[model samples]
Target: MPRTRVHNLNISLDGYAAGEYVTLDAPIGDAGRLFAGFDGRFIHGIDKADAPVTLDRVLTSTWAQGIGAEIMGRRKFGPQTGDWPDDGWRGWWGDEPPFLTPVFVMTHHPRPPIEFANGTSFHFVGGAPREVLGLAQEAAGDLDVRLGGGPSTIRQFLDADLVDVMHLVIKPVTLGRGVSLWEGLSGVEDRFTVETIASPSGLTHQLWNRNVPA
Candidate 1:
């Protein structure tokens, strides 16, 4: 069966997934201070030689594994808002997006699909989490649907109990104020079988799998 999954989501010690003042210049905010320990391959598009074999690298390496389609919030797509001033704003990924499958961008103002040179195609839509998940699942076919997020979007799916598995990387630093991942999610751990692995880079990787009936 196809499942919904969140992979390689980095959160700070203060529970914030991304910092404030998001703009085209700094998508993740704080100049990406939270992702200091992440691999260069993710940030700078560096060669594999520069990336170490740490847990962060190892986990991120499998980011595209079995993922056939992705669903992300509008902010995760780009900094543009209020009617998309220009259709040419492809995305933060440039010409060839890393996601080689169809991507659904959650937004109130839906736009026409943008097809890229690579296999990536961005489709904009606005609906409830469950509704969006259905579209993603249909697009994913037999493969899993990846929930690419920016905290708020992931929280919505978690609240709807639509996520089947999640791999959250807990960075050691704290953002005093920003978008939090666990604000209203009290006792969320009760629904999942939690496992943790500490990496050499001082970050802790946590896997949460939804408990299944025996």
Candidate 2:
């Protein structure tokens, strides 16, 4: 069975995921940019046939083998107002997006279906978190659905207890400002348990698996 997972999500030492002021140019904001690093190496590592052979192996491995579909927030998808003007804008990743599978984007605005190169397709859904996750699960088949976060989106799923697994990369830097990851996470510690903590490249990567009792 496939699980819903969040991967390579970076947070500052102060628990902020992104810095203040997010625009089309700075998607992740200031703090998040440093924590996530400018390089798209994480996605690049997955594009290869052979398994990743470096510090990014863990992330790359999950992306390559387990990913079947992707769910992202509107902000994570692109900077657009209302309905999409045209199909000219595929995504921030250009023609060859890192994801080659079906992608479900959460948005209030409606737009026609977007089909891109490879096997990527963007479907817009305007509904609750559970509804979107259900659709993503159906599309995922036997592979896990990747929860592409934009802070608020991640929090919504987390609040609903829909997230099965989360891999958080705690960057060494301190973002004194911006969106804080722990703002609404009042009960996360009681619900999720830390499974592993790896220190690769001086970055602390923490893995948490849902502890929902059957």
Candidate 3:
């Protein structure tokens, strides 16, 4: 069965996942400190042959494995807000995006699909979390659907009980005010089987698997 999963979401000690605002200059806003230990090169999941063996790489190595399609919010797609500009803005990624798969970007005003030479393509659509997940699942086929998020998006699916697994990277720092991942989700942990692994790098990796009854 294809599942919905979120990976590498970094949350601050204060429960904020992303900064208060995002602009062209500040992609993730003031929450950049959460990703201070991240390396973009390993985004497509790390391989031992690609880099030195480390706990960070090993944990992130699961990012791209057994994943097909990705569903993300508009913010995660870019800093654009309101109606998209007429300007030809492909994305933050250049000609080729790291996610070499079909990406469904959630938006109030849907736009034409954008395709790249690689397997990556961006489909803009608007709908409920379940409805959007259906589209991604179809595109994913036998594989799972990845919820590439910016906190709010993942919270919706999580609220709907649609997310199957999640890997949250809890950083040591704290952002006093920002978009929080745990808002209105006080008891979300009860629904999942949880495990934690703290690295010497001051990062805590948490794995949350939905507790499906046998």
lDDT of 2 by residue, 4-84 (tens): 998877887888776666667876656644555533555645545453456655464565457888999887788676777
| Best-matching candidate per TM-score | 3
Task: Give the Cα lDDT of each candidate.
Answer: 0.86, 0.78, 0.89
TM-score of each model, paired residue for residue = 0.93, 0.87, 0.96
What pairs collide in candidate 2?
A: none
The RMSD of every model to the true structure, in order and in angstroms, is 2.4, 2.7, 1.3
In candidate 2, stretches whose alpha carbon ends up further than 4 angstroms from where it belongs are 32-39, 42-52, 83-87, 196-200
Summarize candidate 1's per-residue lDDT along 1-214 as a digit string, tens digits.
9889998899988899987777988998773767775664642122356544555777776677788899999999988878888657988988878898999999999779999888899999899999999999999999999999989999999999998999999988877888999989998888999999998878899999999867
How many angstroms is residue 121 displaced in model 1 relative to the true structure, after the best TM-score fit? 0.3
lDDT over C-alpha atoms for residue 106 of model 3: 95
Question: Which candidate number has the best lDDT?
Answer: 3
User: Candidates 1 and 3: which is better by TM-score?
Assistant: 3
lDDT of 3 by residue, 1-214 (tens): 8899998888999988999679888889988898786876666556535668678777787788889999999998899889989989888888989889999999998789999999999999999999999999999999999999989999999999999999999999988998999899889998999999988877999999999977
Local lDDT at 48 for model 1 = 56
**Candidate 2 or 1, higher lDDT:** 1
Alpha-carbon lDDT of model 2: 0.78
Candidate 1 overall lDDT versus native: 0.86
